[model samples]
Target: MPNLLRKSFNVVNRVRHTASVAGLSALRVAKGERPDAVMLRETFEQLGTTYIKIGQFIASTPSLFPRDYVIAFQGCLDQTTPLPYSYIEQVLKEELLTEGQSLEDLFSKIDKEPLASASIAQVHAATLPDGREVVLKVQKPDVEVIMQTDLGVLHGVTKLMEKLMPQMRFASISPIIDEIRIRMMAETDFIAEASNIRDFQQFLQMTGNTKVVAPEVVEELTTKRVLTMSRLHGISMVDEVAMRQYCDDPAQVMADTLNTWFASLMFCNSFHADLHAGNLMLLKDGRIGFIDFGIVGKLAPESWQACMGMMQALQDNDYVTMASCMVDMGMTHERDKVDQAQLAGDLAKMITRIMAEDKTYTSGKPFNSKEQADELNKMMLEIVEVGKRHGIHFPRDFALLTKQMLYFDRFMRTLAPDMDMFSDARVSLLGSDFKQ
Candidate 1:
């Protein structure tokens, strides 16, 4: 009971601090003194890991955040002060000694410094006793406890925001918080991540695609809190200049990456939800290395079938079927007085405009001009606005799909300027029928 009270007090204090800072920041922006992205980045860094992870989440989900905030938070770095070596030793000793093995029994040597430190865990470089190089991802002590406290505070804040700003259509905060909680819990379990790695490896093998690589999980060396995996060396896929220097066909690399993701949606039961440049790499052997399978989305067999139906309907210009399929997928609310026909018409009109834009830009012109990108963003915003007016709430899974497509869009603009993503034979969401 005392512990619970302390945790509740901590949550309340944190929420108050966050509210104060946000209020001051809003006031500054209102006075025309907008906070610099660097300042915001620093603020998150000082605020600790949960906020840093939230910033990273905001950076990844552009559809859910304001443009300026998303762009600003993208610069938020995840560098954390390393826990002491004594703490690391203690954790390893506690977690590894149960099976009659000590830290030295498994690893020939463990580095005192970590390779990377984020919100929940830190990665350290190590070498197995069998002479294999590996990276050890160790979870922080009592991370779950801290996360629960922080998330509770976050929920409280979200409630306050909804009550204060009733005009803002901010979606249900509870569901969003629950989703975050679930994903974070999954991330905290190294065993689950190892399973994701193995599943992705099997997926790559089954697809007969040797161009993509998933890291090999070292099962013998893995535990619930600790994961050992093969270390990969490569340049980020987003580094166009570096990738160009390494590969003769960066365009093909981009295409293969997109196709790999598409195949995951069609074949694999689970797909990587986060595919930012940091998580994608152009390996030395020309294979695309996909890392960080912490956040993933799974479509049930029924859901996948429904998605395929919706895609086909969109391709064939069947507005009624598309709207019905969307409703089946729970994208809109079921109100007794809702006008299904009007909703279908609105959806169809919106799809027509989007398809017309693709038709007009079939040449696949370079997206170098800020004006062109801004126009595209404005079109997307307008679509979101229309959907909101119809009481249609886009699910997070849809947002994840759209986010991956946007990455493909940017990559295509840079690599294959002559290839239209919507009209190209290479990009097919509904398989061969939708191929250009």
Candidate 2:
């Protein structure tokens, strides 16, 4: 009865945003009027935060979702209506007062208007009593409760689907949903995010990538719901015009960005999973500023080994080693039943196809060329298809790493037109203890 009541409430809320009872035939009209991907994107936008977050998650995983859905959800921006300052102040006071400090006692001033607004939290520029500049990341009001309710709904649905069709169990929707829940819960807690920022900064220093920097997280002014961190001033990485002004060598700046991030995958305990343009910036000092440490990725020891092997093979253009690594990574079924030679040959053909489409291995903008982009996407999908045909399933982190590389690829096309990404001596991937 309790579950029924909750489901009723969620459906009612969705109905208010999704549709209404105009007439008996109105439901059919609504279905016809909107295509699945477009309708889903629109509904997510209308349903607000949790759905928007789910959409963002789908947008990030092109390998997991249908290509058209991924393309459509990319249009679903994070920009939303700002919460009132009164609520923001309330959250700040409640969080800081728990530490035996009032807002006035700690912060000299906090901008009533937000510095920036995102799907989950809105940031406010603030100054400490000691004149230290910082930004307060305040959680949206009752977001935890809303997320719990929505996730419960998703979980219940997945359970039902699995029960109805056992193949759904193989797809592992429940575990994936649980993973998303844990990550989303972590994002809500500013303290954990603060730790992530510091750790990445440490990783940067350890790797000697002085050009890449993460913000300094302030502990005293931080709580689970609210995070205060040193404000980083810089031009966003996407602003090519401003980037040229910040540094004479934009190409080198971009290399430093990729090198630091790549190094983190091997050296850091966790790599920044979310590298969307919003979180990366080029500081006034010409260093890369990595902000918002929410959504990080980690790999098991064996996974890292497989990743290293794959990276080495990619650089050497050793298709056979690449094929073996893919099998080791569990990108295929029944390892003893696999044909190594055929897999390697298929990979070679795909690479040849990409090379034929665009020769600008250095200067060619594959990202901008529709023919090149299609060729690349088709090549990647074909590899996945062949592996799946052989009963291969890739690890989730494999998809995450692939997506981040695609982002770096776009950055290369824009910032570093003439540089070799993997083969460059400056582009380091090995950790201190890594044998290779």
Candidate 3:
């Protein structure tokens, strides 16, 4: 059989298996048996690369999936079985070889054991001839074929869902799939990741943020399928205990991280989209290091400008301006648009209640109190419900931005109980004060 036909057959078989497993799990749940999220995660893992990636994406995109599924799939960490050393050698020979230098010439010693393996790529620590330690990231062989086939299956499934439920405005699953496909393709190219690193490095240099670090890409030793970058030493930011050992001011580190990300959003044109604990680390040199630049988000100039306006309006307590800016950002559809005047009135009422509860609060800290947090969350939920009733569907980007801010909110509560995110001097956007 042709390679494409064989892959398609495999994909169809995998999809059938997935459906069977999900159905069985549903039946078990219906029978009052507690279904294991880990089992479901493992099922996706067994289905191969694309499903694993989708599982991880589902874990991150809380706004899109149900809470139970998201919580369960969070256990679906990147853990893939390693490829054979022979296959690794073949890839190196085919993809990394230049005019004369061979795999043996490139590395003085190559580790057969992979350091880590994910759905798309695996990392191995290798030593250069000159004694420099580096991490070699190799793209899985035939991954592109597998991803294309799986994505096709995903498209078909999503299309079926849309047809079955016309009222379910699930943000056009096709565009989301297309976006994921673009990102996956870019990720398969190490050269693109190298360029991303260079771009971020240049941004750091210009900004004079000495506390931030990005790994230097070794261009001479890097290729399309394999990337060799300077090996950074440190624990992930999620390791709070380990991080505290390196820096006395873990809160400052968190602050610096938020500041750096905010700066990137305003100035760099491109910002790291996937910044879960794994992608952020505390380096030995007391600086923040960011890795895995394969996925990024770009905001058009107008969108960003409108975002600035929205933030400014929030600060100034001008709900009308905030609503207008949101409209400009296309958060609310025309047909489903709530009465702008009524939205402004309701928002003002909520703001007044909040202000009455805490007169001196300008930061996110005061809301961290359980009662206050509940009230705020309730208010926001009401707002979203009202928007939904009005037929206003929020874009995915807006949802993602809000989710990231919520992450920051949680981080701030843990790290700096008193820090006011809204009024922090370090949280400047676009090199200017937010509209207020």
Best by lDDT: 2
Question: Estimated TM-score per prediction?
Answer: 0.76, 0.84, 0.77
Tens digit per residue, CA lDDT, model 2, 103-163: 7888899999988888789999999899999999998866676777678778998999999
Colliding pairs, model 2: 331-392, 332-392, 333-391, 360-364
Tens digit of per-residue lDDT, candidate 3, span 93-148: 87778788788798898889997787788888888889988888888877777787
Question: In model 1, where do residues sit more than 4 Å from their true spots?
Answer: 1-45, 56-86, 157-171, 244-246, 300-330, 333-371, 430-436
Residue pairs with colliding backbones in model 1 are: none
Local distance difference test values of all predictions, in order:
0.71, 0.75, 0.72
- Supply every candidate's count of residue pairs whose N, Cα or C atoms clash at under 3 angstroms: 0, 4, 0
What's the ranking of the predictions by lDDT, best on top? 2, 3, 1
Task: Give the CA lDDT, 0 to 100, for residue 149 in model 3.
Answer: 73
Worst 10 residues of 3 by lDDT: 427-436
